[model samples]
Target: MNINKQKMIRNVLEQHSNGFYMQTQFVILHNRFFAGTHVHVMLKINNHFLVEHFKYIKLLQMILILELIVFKIAKDLIQYLKIK
Candidate 1:
């Protein structure tokens, strides 16, 4: 994805995370399913928040595993990112 799209998506996630109801976390997680931008990439970015918050580690791990199974190619990349 180009920087603009990346920014747009990250903006969306950030908006949702920030409690702005303009979009939903489900939108990022679903990510147009096989269309538009890649869901794994957005989730990858979102993972940063999950990893940084120790209290949410288990949830973070769950998302990581889900991404691995669902996104296939992202498994190695996410594991390589220190999701542990």
Candidate 2:
């Protein structure tokens, strides 16, 4: 992947973690099955309120995080493959 693409993907993942929808989360995680990165770091100040304010949203965030991590890995892999 190009640097711009990597940046775009990272930005998307960050946003997904910050604000997530359940359906989107499912797609992300499913896509991750093809990635290598298994680590996702997200710091959200409102994360705790997610459960009280919206249970579904909280679950979606979790799913999104998983997917984002995988996506990050996949993006890196693509970049590596291109170089080779």
Candidate 3:
């Protein structure tokens, strides 16, 4: 959600050995997930889909972990609580 994280995700995807399709899908999937309920999109993916997207999976893991940590640790939470 933040610029730094977005930039980092982009870097990871861009640097991947896979072709452009996966990277483009990565961006689309990320936008779709955060745009609404990511759980739903995740549920739609089967193991076959996972295998298809295997290369991006690790990067997705990193993005998800970073996202959770950011939401938990970022000062944006203070703004939400009007604590600033």
Candidate 4:
């Protein structure tokens, strides 16, 4: 993510009632997901997961949808490699 976009997301997140907590959770989840970790497990570990808090947070929902798309592509690639 570019600096401006990062700033925008931070700004939006900071506007939430639980801004600091939400921001911290978002960063942690994002880092773990991009690091190739299982997002489901991370969410489970974090009890107060983002999904529950993200219902009204469109930006987060959009980001997660994109991440899911990337994850699907990666999974398909691995399956294809195994088939070869």
Candidate 5:
């Protein structure tokens, strides 16, 4: 993605990090399917109170992983199109 798109995404994540109420546990568990130990380590370290404090950082990490996966797929698709 371009810089503006990246900035917009970061802004959105930041805005929602506190009051955003979703099944965070489910998302964390699902993330294990993609990234294994790193997410596990992040979960292991944070206690209940610390989780609140660190929630934004955790969200950022998860989003970064997702963004990487998306960019990789986009890159592959572009290469395939060029070859065709």
Candidate 6:
């Protein structure tokens, strides 16, 4: 995975709303998944796990989407600034 995407995923996994347990599990699960396969597999596994973790799936999905969107925007801004 690209470094930015990996960092974004790490950030998302680290995010906590209530306590440490949920975030810890998120990090561990992400680590286990990534350890076994490549980035493509990680994306597929993340999508599947999100489907199974339905309660907060919507929230997680939104966060992931926003993270990507922000990354794209940042990249664009950097390119624009560099062109000036």
lDDT of each: 0.38, 0.40, 0.40, 0.44, 0.39, 0.40
Model 5, CA-based lDDT = 0.39
True-structure RMSD, every candidate: 12.8, 16.4, 15.1, 13.9, 14.8, 14.3
Over 1-84, each residue of candidate 3 has an lDDT whose tens digit, in order, gives 567756775676456423322323333335433444342212111111221122233556645643443334334446656963
For model 5, state the Cα shift of residue 19 in Å: 24
| TM-scores, all models, native as reference | 0.28, 0.31, 0.30, 0.35, 0.36, 0.34
Q: Alpha-carbon error at 42 in model 4, in Å?
A: 26
Residue-level error in angstroms, candidate 5, position 61: 0.3
The model with the greater lDDT, 3 or 6, is 3
Winning model by TM-score: 5
The TM-score of predicted model 2 comes to: 0.31
* lDDT per residue as tens, model 4, 7-75: 776565456423223424444234233334234312221233334222223466545543553445456
The regions of model 1 sitting more than 4 angstroms off are: 18-38, 41-84
Each model's total of backbone clashes: 0, 1, 0, 0, 0, 0
Angstrom error at residue 19, model 4: 24
Q: Once all C-alphas are superposed, what RMSD does model 4 give against the true structure?
A: 13.9
Please identify which of the two predictions, 1 or 5, would achieve the higher TM-score against the true structure.
5
* Alpha carbon lDDT at 27, candidate 2: 22
Judged by lDDT, which candidate is best? Answer: 4
Candidate 5 residue lDDT tens string, 1-84: 255644554565445444221312212322332333444211111111112112233545666544444445456657877999
lDDT of 2 by residue, 1-84 (tens): 355644555565556553432223222222232243332333232122111121222334545545564555456657877999
Q: Please give the RMSD of candidate 6 to the true structure.
A: 14.3
TM-score of 4: 0.35
The digit string of per-residue lDDT tens for model 6 on 1-84 reads 456656666666556323322322232223333334321211222122221222222336545543453445456657877999
lDDT tens readout by residue for model 1, 39-73 = 43232333432222212223344345444433443
Better of 3 and 6 by TM-score: 6
